[model samples]
Structures are given as C-alpha cells and as structure tokens.
Target: MQKSDYFIKGILESDEKVVAKIYNLFFPKVLSFVYRNNGQREDAEDVFQKALLQISARIKLRKLEVINTSFEAYLFTACKNLWRRELNKKQKRVTNDEVKELVSEESDMAYALLDQERWELFRDKLEQLSDNCKEVLNLFLKKVSYDQIVKKLGYTSETVARQRVFKCKAKLIEMIKADKRFRNLK
Candidate 1:
C-alpha cells in the first residue's frame, strides 16, 4: 500500500508502524515550523514526538476525534496547543481575551505539569542565547551531523561549531537555573 494509506491506517488503528510513518511524513514540517517560532531543533523534534504520543493517547481514550480535518492539521494543532500550555504554565500569565486567543486549547491548563514544563523552560532560555549560538544549537539539534553543520553554518571546522554548541548549551542551562521562573526545575 501507499505511504499515505499506511499513515491513515496507523492513525485509525493506533498502530506503531503507522505512527512512525506519520512521523516521517509530517514531523519535519512541524519541527521546522516550531524551530522558526523561537523553538530549537531539539525542542521542535521533542514537541513533535510528544504530540504524537498525545495523539495516540487521545485516540485510545477517544478524547481526540478527527473527522474532516487533515491529519497534518490535527497533529500541528495538537503540538501547538501542548506547547502553549507549557508556556502558560511557566509564564503563569493571567487569563485574558488576548492571551486566550493566543492559545488554542484550554483543557491542558487543568492537567498537572509533566516533564514538559522543564523542557519548555529550556526552550525559552534557548532564545536568550546569542544569535550565532541559537543558530548553531538549532542546526545541531536537528541532527544535521557535525559535517553538515560545519558546511551549512560556514564554519571552518566541525570542532568550532561543536564548541559553540557546548558553550551555548551550558550557558542556557545556567541561565535557566538562575532564573527564578525556571530554577525550581533544576
């Protein structure tokens, strides 16, 4: 059968293979989208994976029902909602029409924080890094492979890029720990 059919089957039956197929099909776009939106490649990849897990759970629990919408839309919306929830929890911003409109779902707000809160906090810190650091980390997190990173980033050598990634990540972790909003997670 075709790949599309395979993915549809996976969604319909909650089959692992189908889930994997769906991941291959749409995760790239979602990851790129997330990274472009102040998320790192790792953050995007992680969010996409967790979104799939959530989708599987919702399907199993009958909490998510997809009728006419494209699977890609459903998956993206779910991931986006999940990310917003993590942001709100970390930001702890008061509810307002403008803020509410900025988010897509409200139910996740009621659930207890999982590992997601910490990850989102980390993502926030990633944005605080210098532009070069953020770019390097984002590319590295996307699994560009060391050689590819050197090539794409215009680095003279893989070692330089690697060092930057290390320094940036270290600084990000330190900043997150120092920040009152995220210190509790450490």
Candidate 2:
C-alpha cells in the first residue's frame, strides 16, 4: 500500500497516532492555504477540522477509494474549498488570480467533496419531509418525468404530480433554510 493508503486506513480505523501524524504533517500547508485566502489561524484550524470530518465520513461510508492525489493534496484542497465557501458565505469573493493557482484536478476533487457534502445535507433534509414529498422529490432527482411520476406514485394526473413536486420542493427548501447546520455551512 502507498503511504497515503496507510493514512486512509488509519482514518478508517480511527487510529489516533496516525491521525496526529497526519495533522502534524499537513496542518501547516492547510494553515497557509487558509491564511492566504483571507483567513486567520482559528479559521484555518476550523477548516482543517471540517475537512478531516468530511474525509472521515467518506471513508466510513466507503465512498473514498484508491485516492489519485496525495493525501496531503486532497486534505489541502478540501481545506481550501471549505475556506472559499466560508468566505463566500460572508459575501467575500475569491479573486481570479487565487483561483488560477489551484491545480485543476485538485480543485475538481475539492468541488466533488463540497458537492457530496451539500447532497448529503439535502438528503438528510429530504428525509424529514412527508412521505409523499419524499417520493416526489426522489423521483424528480432521478430525472423521472412528471407523467412517469404520476403513474409511479399513482397521482391523479400530470398536473397533480407537478403541483406535488412544486409543493414538496418548496417544503424541502424551507426545511433546508431552517437548519442551523445549513446556516453554518452557508
């Protein structure tokens, strides 16, 4: 196994010594990344923690496998993405020059992580909706047409399916907006 695979295994097993080694080895780079992106020491720490949590979650769910990038690179990219999102939440825009410095592949991995996080959040919120709403939204997410949804869900007509989808979507949005974690992520 590669050195990074050991780190991934360590993370999966929750090995404290390995985790500490990862932090000791990679934290400085992540810190510099956050600081360069208009963040402070505390912000860097927060970003690192969030990135670690994201990585751990993915590992536990078996979502991460055969990492193509170095572990440090993946972690740093995640930190950068998290910091960028935090800055955006505060209404700050990252400059084009800063963006240009990111490796395309690393940035793509970072974005995939961010997208997965958002999708997970949305899915959690979706589960809190009524059964009919969940059904409609799940079908909609799968690109099922309204006519098909009506047939599948036994709705009266395509118009009813559309209305249900609209209402369910509105509820889902409202639930997402009301979540404290959602606010924090934003």
Candidate 3:
C-alpha cells in the first residue's frame, strides 16, 4: 500500500503511534498556516483536531476516496478549510447583546462535511476545464477587474476578457451541474 494509504489505514484502525506520527509530522505546518491566517494557537489546535475528526468521520462514512495529493497536503487542506469556515462563522456571528442560536458540534461537523463535498465537486470540475478557462474563471471568481484580467491574460480588451470569463464560468457551471454529486450538494 502507498504511504498515504497506510496513514489512512492507521486512522481507520485507530493506531496511536501512527496518529502521533501524523500529529508530529503535520501539525506544525497546520499551526503555521492558522497563525498566519488570523488564528491563535488554541484555534490552530481546535482546527487540527476538528480536521482529524472530519477525516475520521468521512472515512467511517465511506466518503473518502483517493488522496490525489500527499496525505500531508490533504490534511493541511482540510485544516485550512476548517479554519476558513471558522473565520466565516466568526465574521457572521452576532454581538453578545443579540439573541444567539446554539449549534451543536455534530451539526457543525455535518455542515462542514457537506461544504467540503461541494467545494471538492467544484474543484474537480474546474480541473476539467482548459488552462485558459481555469485562469479566467479563477481571476473572475476572485473579483478581479476586467481590465486587470485583460492585462494579465494578454487579452485585446476588457470586452474580450469579459466574454472569456462569462464563457468559462458558464462552462464550469455546466460541468458542475452535470455531475451526479451536484444534486446532493445542492
């Protein structure tokens, strides 16, 4: 089996030594990323734990497939995604004076899992596009100005950039919508 599969199996089998190795080998990178991304040490720790749990849950549910990247990359991405979700939640949180709704951990995990699925689906479809389409769509999605996109992509004019962005976005959406997973994601 591949090294990544060994880690996955360790996770699946609840091997303490393997888990410890993962934490030792990977957690420092996660900590660094979280620290750079408006997160504290505790936040990093929380996100790391949650990411592990998320992976565990996905494996148990048979939702995890191939780790197209390294296990380290996958874990780091999972942690990054969880951290981003946490940041968004924080931004959208009401003040202490306002009425607060209690959300359970399980519910939060469920939402995160579903959100991850949607993101993966979108990412996979995005990979199917031409390189030009990927670049145009990425810049467009980032809200880059048409002029900037035109300059960056060496387009003749903003209108051409706009057209390319529109076409690329439409193609991406069509591809995503054509996926069987799209229905469940929605």
lDDT of 3 by residue, 1-186 (tens): 998999999998999999999999999999999999988999999998898888899888955878777999878888888899898877767445566686789999888888777877888899999999999988988999999998899999999998998899899999999999999889
Best by TM-score: 3
Off by over 4 Å in 1: 1-112
Q: What digit string (tens of lDDT, one per residue) describes model 1 on residues 1-186?
A: 644344555866778777777778888888777776677778777777677666555455544333234677656766776666555654655544345434434344324233444555666688889998888889878887988888888988989888878988898878888888675554
Provide the lowest-lDDT 10-residue window in model 2: 92-101
lDDT value, residue 121 of candidate 3: 85
Per-residue lDDT, model 3, residue 41, is 92
Ranking by TM-score: 3, 2, 1
Tell me the number of clashing residue pairs for each predicted model.
Answer: 0, 0, 0
Q: After superposition, how far is residue 146 of candidate 1 from its true place, in Å?
A: 1.0
lDDT of 2 by residue, 1-186 (tens): 899899988987889999999989999988888778788999998888878877887777646676555888777767777777677655533444343433464564456575655655686788889998888889999999998998899999999999999999999999988887687466
In the order shown, what is each candidate's alpha-carbon RMSD? 15.4, 12.0, 1.9
RMSD of 1: 15.4
| Residue pairs with clashing backbones, model 1 | none
Give the C-alpha miss distance for residue 100 in model 3, angstroms: 1.0
